[model samples]
Target: MSPDLYTVIKQICEEKQIPEESVVSTVELALAAAYRKDFADKLQNIHVTLDAQTGNFRVFDMKLVLENVSARIKEEALKLARQKKKAALYMPEFHDHDDEKFNADGVDLNDDDKLIEEGKVLLKFNPRTQITISDAKKIYPDIKVGDEYKEELEVPGDFGRMAAQTAKQVIIQRIREAERSIVFNTYKNREGEMVSGVVQRVEGSVVIIDIGRVNAILPYREQMAGDEYRIGGRLKLVIARVEMTPKGPEVIVSRTHRDLVSKLFELEVPELESGTVEIKAVAREAGSRSKIAVVANEENIDPIGSCVGQRGARVNAVIDELHGEKIDIIEWSANDEKFIASALSPAKVDSVEILDRDERRAKVTVKAEQQSLAIGKGGQNVRLAAKLTLWKIDIVQSETNAVIEISDDEPGDDTENVSQ
Candidate 1:
């Protein structure tokens, strides 16, 4: 209402990141609601205007220019009085004349006359029902009945301290909701990407992570097995899934996915990321064991050795992030026999017999001393190898006696020259 209104609106627009036009529109709606409570019922055509230069605002009630006003009112009355058609004479009294004003004898006046009188009555108003106008000239000469009024909106005085307090509370609540919604939408589309979040709280096996804006739930199933999350600790996780619910979007992030291992390698192993070396496969038993296979496109570059780095420095950093998880880096090979043998590392394979090429099933025979090493501790090694090669593997000791009845189509080795 005062010059300060412009400043107030502009400041709110900038602070909220809401457009200036939107602030004006919101203020107009609020004024319209106030006017409706204090003024008229035919508010459909009400309009609000704000002066850009001075921030002066005005409310105007508008009505269509009817060719026959009396007829229109009669039509409106009939539409509302349809039930009285059978008893027209006994129907409730309906008047086209105005009801807000009356003569001294209590006879209602015409609509136009009543409007003028009510306007005057409304202008001389109270705190909850009125606004002020300032005129420097007339001893106050700038004032007029229909001219735009001015007032400084003092939140505590104009609205009573309690009402102003309530408004402050409302604004704070709305802001919190807006911030939550912004964060939810921002992270909802981040499926399959890495995110850094702080551990806000841990309940049972679930950790509530605060990702700067909103809290995201990290379920136990999505976390690396046996991973211990402490409050206020920072974590880097990959968004695995997003579920839209009535409240908002629920994002499931993980540190245990096979892709997570690949991503970590991509971050730590520059050779694997640069296309000189490509990651072929990643098999992870999170917090326990992981196997990654890589291939070098350039000659003389050993992909496995490069990823391991000097004295295992490069891969060690990644393994430390997984809470001391063990990592096995192996060379990627297109040859299934070589790949399967490479996957089952720390053990030498005597032979790898491809039993079913279509099924990708193979039997890996290792010497007696290498049997325990080939299978690894509790079979973790062989399991990871199977996953890395994407093959079904059967491990057998080389000395194990077995009889194989080969079909006649299978050729036998020729030893006639050696015998002679």
Candidate 2:
């Protein structure tokens, strides 16, 4: 390779963070495609190798030996392929790498179950890269089925301008595709994990963030209420999902997902990270308040204390990240009644009765003075408690004994037994 070309490739590998081997292989494939487009026939199995150490080229016409297919079958397939109208049954011109067609079971091959049951090795032969056993025996007597037969071809001295242009296009396109794959995989594995990013720009309600590898988007639905995403401001976020668009991979980051709190706690508390303490459940109303339940695996460790930190340092950090949103950490209990009571924190439950075990319905009674505290502003407390426990909770004031339920679907509907 030329020193200039080597330097450029090295720079590209460093900047793109792509493997050198992948780039080199891509270059070789692009060169092969260009050579085929300019100098080879259609369906010709063309192979080209380029030496990195000392810029040298090798060209080959590669073919695979067909074990059971005969020349007569090849003739029939070619004939059918030429007849355009009758080609669907033979799946003519439907070529993968070898430009060959396979018809298994001849049933509606679309049905996966039937195809797997009755399917067998069936080939509509292509004469280009596949050679019959008899023809291969004549060329090389000891050649075996499924073995590659390579014929050395003379290398051309120079490629035309059009072919060179095609190679450049292929190299650009392939490198872009590789980069997209890398981004998709990197963010896909990070779903439900915390990531920090700088606000790049805002497109209406959607805020775009620059997160090192890719530009992740925080859509309107995932944004916390009253949260400002000012340009160049840094924010902690969790990746909700990664999807591939026609343009590229779209990394959907969220600040409102319940997992965001779990991840934040994990970062703040070493006990949570080390498995001494775990977050049992979390229910969040973004930018307002959240309730989380914690459990301890070790007897000596206090899960609540670990999450709360010394004088509220750990949870304060999470609250700061959430833009002053309130968080209530409660001890998780195994007893259903106790857990339901604890789910409604700060209310001082008088009693908890499982009204319907099958439907996960519970009745929580509190003193008349504590009724508003249990319901919270616009019934947010009871709403989050019901969500956190995955139970339909009915709040009853002991003095009046009137049951009231918070409807999470229709916000502000604190109707009696409306049920979320």
Candidate 3:
């Protein structure tokens, strides 16, 4: 209970990593609270000061020196006069000595001689507080009265015991708020980037991830399909967005964002990172299929092969990161016909003729045997091709002999003359 307040404050500040000034303020407030417990609420108006050097604190009831004392002893009249006087004098610029012994002409002498007598006559009193000088010097031998000091008040042994339980609750609440802010800020600007995190827990389909210092919300909607999350698992994810709230920040994280695919490629493909190979566009069904169109800015580098790596090792690593999501890397072409042809890969085509490039529609004639492969199971292949090439493609069997008609407004134009 008689611990050195200065050392106690310093130790607390160091332990909590809080500034010394903040610890001083917290101690001052705690003493104010103890004073309120010991005295009436009116004493709440009393100011408590802390000895910064000695860490001793005390309370003082300050009053203004005024003339014309009333003897009525009617507390009601005294209260009214105090209220009116407080209003005029205690504006924004009110100071401690404003109410100290001043004459009717507003002159004051800095002498404590009128202390007891003046205490009765003053209609307006401004209470000020500070740690007692005796207590301050006990904590720090170098401290003295009239010298400003910050004092740490001891929370009573009983209160300390109770606070052990209460502090846990209070700290837990405060920490959650602080952590939310940390998480929010960390992920808010990482919308299109990948972040590594530790899995803290799982709630149903959602995973609560510790993305460094804060818990990022990994919703089921953003998780890769069929990926199971176990507690304490490490994850690499894309930050979806950060949301603000009254308490703190909320971060939404995703494994399924299209950027996740691109980011993985960036991590895996050295050529892409060096800017020799550029990922022109990416379309993903997420956890099912994804297609990326890449171009070689440097002519010597084969963009598709570079992304694929030797024997499909690089792209396979990306697929494993995505929990076995299928990836197709296609060469990007400036020619719409060539690009569309590549977009629908692994299927041989007879020929492709542009029905309307501006309208983003094209007709392709594939061998009857390649029709099923071009269309794919459940039309996934062509759908991905549309998204990848940014064009609408209609695959027709060459055996059907069906001609893809252009608008009648067009004059004689031979479709075969179109370049591949």
For this target, which candidate reaches the highest TM-score against the unseen true structure? Answer: 2
Tens-digit lDDT string for candidate 1 (171-235)? 45544445446556677777777778888888888888887545788887778765778888887
Q: Write model 2 residue lDDT over 1-420, tens digit each, in one string.
A: 243655666777899888887777777777777787678754356777777555676877676777655444555545544433211111113323533346444556234344334432124355555666777788789999877766677777788898889889988988898889888998899887889999999999999999889999999988998798789999999898999999999999988887788889989999988988888878787888888899899898898999999999999999999989999999887798998889788889999998888888888999999999999888889998887777788999999999997533435211121112
Q: After superposition, how far is residue 202 of candidate 2 from its true place, in Å?
A: 1.1
Candidate lDDT (C-alpha), each: 0.61, 0.76, 0.64
Point out the worst 10-residue segment of candidate 2 by lDDT: 83-92
Q: Candidate 3: deviation at residue 419, Å?
A: 26
Ranking by lDDT: 2, 3, 1
lDDT-better candidate, 1 vs 2 = 2
Residue pairs in clash, model 2: 1-55
TM-score for each model: 0.59, 0.85, 0.58
- Report model 2's TM-score to 2 decimal places: 0.85
TM-score for candidate 3? 0.58
